[model samples]
Target: MARLAQVTSSRNREVVAGFDNYADAERAVDSLSDKGFPVEHTTISGVGLRLVEDVLGRLTYPKAAGLGAVNGLWIGLLFGVFLALFTTNAVAWFAVILWALLWGAVVGAVAALIWHALSGGRRDFLSASQLIADRYEVLVDPAHAERARELLQTSQS
Candidate 1:
């Protein structure tokens, strides 16, 4: 798309027509040539089809999933702090940190479990637009507008 704008703008003169899609573009060429306007050039791009697998298809989860684990771990640590401050007889804050780590591990494990369930162990992304060339854009010269239309009409009939 970027290239299209760049090329069209730079050329400024010789581009008969620029079509994002293929069908209309081809018709443009057929019609123009029929009208005695020799098609200077034709460019076919992204025509046939596109196959895009979902991201899940490639990875179990996004890297950010690890951030979730880290968050759960932090929460678990906070909970451990609460336990040590109010429930536990141990005066050492280190004990709180250790308990927090244990909880964090449990949280991380739970997260991994949840992710596995979501992905079914087969992380894949959605893919679409296998092929899309239903329409095309046509451009005409300053001189052959009516002739182009006539030619296209005749060709269609």
Candidate 2:
């Protein structure tokens, strides 16, 4: 005999606690898990989201060229290895790899230099962007919501 599995609807899920930050919500969930609560039944949600951009550093021609050259070097090395597999001679394999790496670095550096020069100082800064939330909520299945809240409260005490 095959038994049907139980499915809990979204309506049966409710928010047990709200936190000002994601770490706090995560800690709350961890506490619930430590208390033998089913951690899988819990979920974290961010509310009141905002996009933020943080400047890392100024981007210069030298930096841009260096980045391009490093990327090109790796790509060229990979291509060389792939090409080497098709050749039967050991010397040809080494020759192909050397030539590929040299050309790749030269081409990549030149290309990036040209690109940076063409930008004319319009966008010269490097930055990281992410979406951040003002608050994070811990939600759990209705059956476990009360227990989760109790566990979280006890942990804080």
Q: Which structure among the candidates has the greatest lDDT?
A: 2
TM-score of each: 0.31, 0.63
Q: Which residue pairs collide in model 1, if any?
A: 24-136, 54-125, 54-126, 55-125, 56-123, 56-124, 56-125, 57-123, 57-124, 57-125
Best by TM-score: 2
lDDT of 2 by residue, 76-148 (tens): 8989888988888999999999988987787888888888899999889888999999999988888888888
- In TM-score terms, candidate 2 sits at 0.63
Flag regions of model 2 displaced more than 4 Å.
Answer: 1-12, 57-60, 76-104, 110-122
Residue 141 CA error for candidate 1 (Å)?
Answer: 50
Estimate, for each residue in 1-62, the C-alpha lDDT of model 1 and write its tens digit. Answer: 97776457433333444467676667667666666665543333343455643333333354
